[model samples]
Target: MKCIMDDLTVYTPSPPAGQNALVVFPQARECPELPPSGYAPLRGSAPLGRVMLRDGRSAWAVTGHALARELLSDPRLSRDRSHPGFLAPEEWSAEVGTHGASPALVADPGDEAPHRPPLPYLTPRRTAALRPHLQRIADRLLTGMERQGPPADLVSAFALPMSALAIGTLLGVPYEDHDFFEGCSGRLLRGRTVREAATARAELERYTGQLLDRKRHEPGDGLLDDLMRQDGQGSLDRARLVTLPGTLLARGHETTADLVALAAFTLLRHPEHLAVLRAGKTPMTAVAEELLRCLATPNGILRVAVEDVEIAGRTIRSGECVVFVTALINRDATVFAEPETLDWDRPAGHHLAFGSGVHECLGRNLVRAQLEIALGSLFTRFPGLRLAVPAEEIRSKPANPTSDGLLELPVAW
Candidate 1:
């Protein structure tokens, strides 16, 4: 099966001749706890190798930890798909080209936002400060689940709502409008076609523009208020001001939602490790770090080279694609001793679960706090919480470069 992405055609590309690529999503579902073994042959042969994309175009896959970091920081490679060579697929043209979002996508480091408005608001200190507030949100959601009883779909019951509420609260988006925004967000992920995505994008853009206007008159403590304050200083122009919330409000929450659900599932899969976590044998903070490293998104990041360059003993022509295997890099045996085993005792903070360089995840701090708190709250609230079905019965989203989250995680106490 092709990669499960927005309602578009999912393509699984095989390598041309000698090239190798992580070409399918079915492998990802075969084992939810690990990245596809297809990545193994590519990594085993070399740290960097040529790969094939859906278009039968070749890309460079960086599987090593150190090299992924070096290239991640290099400005020579760009996220701007308009570059002659970037060749961002047609589906992405609307998002990167039409949106012109300064902060980029959630997975995007958003390093390019020149004096981006949300930076001050997203710092680790500030996001960490939201912990108490976020905890209340998480507690409230978990309580709702308990009242409803078990056999609940954790993705809907706990993960999605928790993430949506937290991000909505952070950005000051009205909670009442979450249903509308959530529908728009899913469509944006992958529309039935480019047209559907474009429609979703347009609706979201309109909503954000209107929301900005509303916030201007009714100021609040959320990030949007601060962005308005920046706009007053002429720091943010009409385009950025109008789109910032839509950009943040959409990707910000969904990105964390996938991670939350994945981490919870990962723990339940490992009963012994879950026991250690429950007993506090290892720090929850450290456990969160390990989960990020071990189960980091496998799709990695894509960068287009503006100029021809050589790295890891290979030459990449300008416009060629560069893939960083975040999942594999975090599992590098050289950097991570026994990378396959999820060991919280080790120092795992340095892992590249989130892309690195200028585009490193802006939501990093908030996500960390959420993951730690969400997990802690989950087990504490329902000590007996466990999978409601056989492991194989669970469904994994078709693998996509952006996410491999479960369609729904059924849980019971």
Candidate 2:
């Protein structure tokens, strides 16, 4: 592949770090362009190489399939955002605000601090308790759909609303507040201006604090209430409980909603797979896993090196930011035969869709459950379901590397 650059220098990895690093660039595919917010892969290739980021700083874009996997699991890489000089290049840094740094980045690999429970409110016990409530929400959503009739946009009518409701119910937020939460989450993730993101964070924090206060005085049958009890027990702190639930509410819905929409889109695009799924004999479990793998994002995981380390023969200097492209690794032609082809029955091996290390997504089970029920019920409910708009015309969010917001997925009975 021809490498393109503007004021960027490319470096080929020396012997043993694999061969020359292949530099994937923008314009490699006909898909929607990436949002201008964060660093993400533009294309795929072999080995490691240096590229000048838009800020005029030398950065490494590790593109090799094997090398990306190796680097992702390497302990030398850190996910802590607090490391010195760790922000994106100067140009990018000027656009974002820094939050108080966490000790995660420099903490020892064995340290429990970085691996602290992601959500104090959504504890394992609370998650189990919320199951019946979740089922009720799912049932209500399906019932509403049945009464409203089909020929609806699943993205708008079913997937988005249902996800928002489930996440909100878990966090003690009313379903009516979906639009507010959605806007706040979107701004936090994709805001181009630092001030915008900071404003959103403050608003979210204030909202969560009020909710927590309500839970303390008049507890609801929700995770937030359970967190209040945990706090009273001294097992959780007030600040931790408040902030964690807000983060959970933001993360819980959006990604799963996208996955459900994308999985439907993928199955519909390949009618053969749709037929297999509709047979009702083959378990939906396998199909869900395959969809997760196939739809893996190109951006991978971000981590900074805590110390100088040698890997695959090359020495990685401390303080360098390393990104592992899971999307590229999952599709490695060597590990997965006919990687680009989606096989519903592909045998499960280790895939990085949920990530590899301790930081792997804690909500993996819930996401799988949501996808299974949502996709299965959707296909079963609307046998004639299909896309409303032309595939080429689908609108996506700016700065997002994956499928766009899936505008108006009209489906029919």
Highest TM-score against the true fold, candidate: 1
- RMSD for each of the candidates: 5.9, 7.4
Query: Candidate 1: minimum summed lDDT over ten consecutive residues — where?
Result: 1-10
Write one digit per residue (lDDT tens) for candidate 2, span 1-413: 22122211233323225433333221112232211111233332235555443344445556455677667677778766557634332223221223211112112122236535435444566666666666666677767877888656776667776666667766677656666876675565444555665576678778888878766777777666766776787876767765654455445555676667767877887789889889976677788887777666333455678888776566668987665555555665666677667787686445667776666776776676677778877777678877656666554432232223344466656
Q: What C-alpha lDDT does candidate 1 achieve relative to the native structure?
A: 0.72
Clash tally for model 1: 4
Q: In model 2, which runs have C-alpha deviations exceeding 4 angstroms? A: 1-29, 32-58, 61-70, 84-132, 139-152, 172-203, 217-221, 401-413
Which residue pairs come into collision in candidate 2? 21-47, 22-46, 35-399, 396-404
RMSD value for candidate 2: 7.4
The estimated TM-scores of all candidates read 0.85, 0.73
| lDDT tens digits by residue: candidate 1, 1-413 | 23221211222346446654444211344466667655555665457876555555667878799888898898888887556666444332222323212122433322345624355678877787788889988898898899999899998888877876677677777767867766676666445555665577678779878888888788877777777887788876767755665556445655677789989998898889999999988888899999989878545677899888888778878878887777778878899897778788999999997788777877888888999999999998889999999887887665544555777899999
Q: How far is candidate 1 from the true structure (C-alpha RMSD, Å)?
A: 5.9
